[model samples]
Target: LKMGEFSNGLFGCFNNCTLCLITYIAPFGIYFVAKTREKIREQKGIDGGFGSDCLVHLFCPLCALVQDAQEIQPAAQAESMARE
Candidate 1:
């Protein structure tokens, strides 16, 4: 969990098949993808702007979605574990 590094590679979507499948099948999943990117930006202090986010999603939708999911998953898991 490095500050600015992605825990999962862009093509490593199968590592979390559920997320991959959801992003692939969900029609409203674009909203989810945008939120995920925002979370990554905040959590990692990323400087990439809205335009870049849009371009990434427009050009590489699935990969971007999967990567965003992979980036946020670890932090979410850790928070859930801490709650217990």
Candidate 2:
């Protein structure tokens, strides 16, 4: 699954400086929850159960966002390709 540099650990904070800054400060939980739900819908999950999900978001929040984007985007691209 291809993801934006801003969303990959290797190229994350280095590329998305502004976002990382914000994440470092706030670690927006609402955004994380929404992205998590989107990933769940795509059937690309980080693991079920509310507690684990919350822990991942509460701790490594940037990585969580990156993960959700990475998981959902590739599947979406594949589905679009299949339709074509």
Candidate 3:
């Protein structure tokens, strides 16, 4: 996950909490959360999968960052290719 800056206050405390939560808690919990939600959604015959809220709030940013990193990678690769 990409790290962001933090400052002091309630917001900062919450941010710190979320950072820790995502780093420690989310990895273990997310899989089960997604799986259970998926099963429920499937049983309910919903078209969309689980974690839409979380996806919008968390995964979307990560996805965009990944895309940005991927875009930069090709240019870096090209530069390395040229150097060789």
Candidate topping TM-score = 1
Candidate 1 lDDT, 4-84, residue by residue in tens = 968888899999889888767553555556666876898899888755776677679989988888888898999999999
Worst 10 residues of 1 by lDDT: 25-34
Q: How many backbone clashes does candidate 3 have?
A: 0
RMSD of each: 15.0, 11.4, 13.7
Cα error of candidate 3 at position 58, Å = 7.6
Can you rank all candidates by lDDT, best first? 1, 2, 3
**Model 2: how far residue 3 lies from native, Å:** 39
Model 3 RMSD, rounded to 1 decimal: 13.7
Question: lDDT score, residue 27, model 2?
Answer: 67
**Model 2, range 1-84, lDDT digits (tens) per residue?**
977564477556768789888877656775568556655744753446655666667778788778777767887999999999
Q: Which stretches of candidate 1 lie over 4 Å from their true place?
A: 1-32
Candidate rank order under TM-score: 1, 2, 3
Tens-digit lDDT track of model 3 for 5-81: 54576545465776767755446545554555455447556566456623532456556345445645787899999
What's the C-alpha lDDT at position 20 in model 1? 84
